[model samples]
Target: MPARRRQQGPRRLEEFAFINLIKRRFGRVPRRVAMGIGDDAAVVRGPSTRDWVVTTDLLAEDVHFSLDTTSFDDLGYKAAAANLSDIAAMGGSPTYLLIALAIPTTLSQSDLSRLYQGLHRACRPHHVALIGGDTSSSRAGLFLTITLIGEIARGRAVLRSGARPGDLLYVSGTLGESQAGLMLLGKALTRGIRRGLAPADRARLIGRHRRPTPRVALGEALASRRLATAMIDLSDGLSGDLAHLCEESRVGALLDRSALPLSPALRRFAALAGSSAESLALQGGEDYELLFTLSPRHEAAVQRLGRQLRVPVTNIGRMMPARFGMKERDRHGSLKDLAVTSYRHFT
Candidate 1:
């Protein structure tokens, strides 16, 4: 579920930050540990044979979000939600969170409280605890970081390399809506003109862009039922994200363009932006939905999961032999090569 974070040259970090990064990276985990650095989090052995899932995420001012289109409350909410999504992708239950922030001189005390308030709002429902974190002054805009600790049953954490040739690719909820929402928040001149939209529609689009929900419950359900062979969160676009999974599994895939799950909001927004819905759904990042693959035999079970969770799940394609290559088939029955169209943060 971890997205590819684009890094600049060498990064200068605080002493503790440096230690955490280096230790977590090069330090060897004990025999009891389940995983390290490769999966959603560093899963270690917990009490009573439970597995501990730990992950950290960052949200920089201009790099991840801008104040122009986002509020402090949503910013705090989204930062926590991003880390929560990582736990969800791992089929773990989020239990504790540590928030670190680099505050700017431009913000007031009241504003800072509102930010924490938003974080609390997100954690209350999931029963996640706010442990502690460090605070620092920033010369630039706000920089936020979150470290989430979660738990799952031992040996139950799903990975992205289990996908096989006959496994069917499935995605939870709709795609492209988040990107379409971001487009609406961009420049008015660049976004183009559209009319006859209701207030609710505008709110829906903007909300999707600002705040997104993590599929935690559904993730646990999928893992508990042994429904998914491989699972990953859609932080990057489906195009590049799926390629990462395929590469890890040593397989190829075929995406059915006609079966892509898109929303009415996406169609309407694409028409206004003079772009196609499929392109947005394929390349748009930050949707935060679950994309996993399962065997064809589980088709009936997947349908049941969809209904039980009240989450719309779509079978977009199937895994193929590596020699066949990763490609997409259009509704017109045309086969085309698929490209890694995901956004690179550094670029």
Candidate 2:
């Protein structure tokens, strides 16, 4: 007798079939499978000589982006970039990715191909392969979930911990540009509805919103060279992400407002938006730059590395005694308690 089809809902059978196939092919149970289908990426053992690094990120329509505002190619690129940044945070080299996409049946074949084209663009530079994936139709908007696997030398993978008192806090690249770009795009989109904007400006702001760069090479360089003591990615804004690094290290920090890098365009955008550059620098998210801590001894080396990589490394602050409090020093040298926060899922 043939087995009856399970009526557990669409794709449930497919999901089970996939899981069973993996178990059957791999034979031995997955060790260090820190994660699997349900939550995020599946984490398995790294090479005997290395520590494993794993991360996952989800991209959804409307919440994360809008098709009306972004190109499908850029959307795919940014989605992969986001996950690659996570692996970069651990100072690891991305190896492979498993993609799971849910899209509406209405999507055309060309649209799907364009999305994959974006994914390929982002993955190729990092030498990341799309080894496997699953696809399904959804009644709602498009969704993409990527699981990234990376590897680092044994006991050398950087983590949020390991920061100590007096270590310097640094960030690669300027802040607020992404947010400024966002604001600009939003305005342009609204204006485009009425009068539209110049082709150049529209293209610039739209590009920023659609595609973002991930500092993977810089992260690996910092790790392999032992430049940063602790590190994390700036996906959630500088203030909030800095707090994460400090919290993990059981330390606090003092950010210098004047030291932050702001682009001229971002400055104009912030001004138009009735916000300050400092505010945007502190709270703007999705920068995808590296926010890290390093000992004073490595400062020179870090600078040299930055020059080699052609990326700026700004020393914005230093780790402080937790009891001293997290504060920001203004241009006048006035110290005020800094309320560290960032964009959250629920918020």
Model 2 Cα lDDT, one tens digit per residue, 165-219:
8999999988867766676656443553323344554455446556777888898
Worst 10 residues of 1 by lDDT: 1-10
Q: Model 1 TM-score?
A: 0.84
Which one is best on TM-score? Answer: 1
Which lDDT value does model 2 have at 240? 89
lDDT of 1 by residue, 200-272 (tens): 6667777876778888998888887888988888888899889988988888999999999988877777776
Q: Pairs clashing in candidate 1?
A: none
Once model 1 is optimally superposed onto the true structure by TM-score, how far is the C-alpha of residue 141 displaced, in angstroms?
Answer: 2.2
Off by over 4 Å in 1: 1-46, 188-196, 344-347
True-structure Cα RMSD, model 1: 8.4
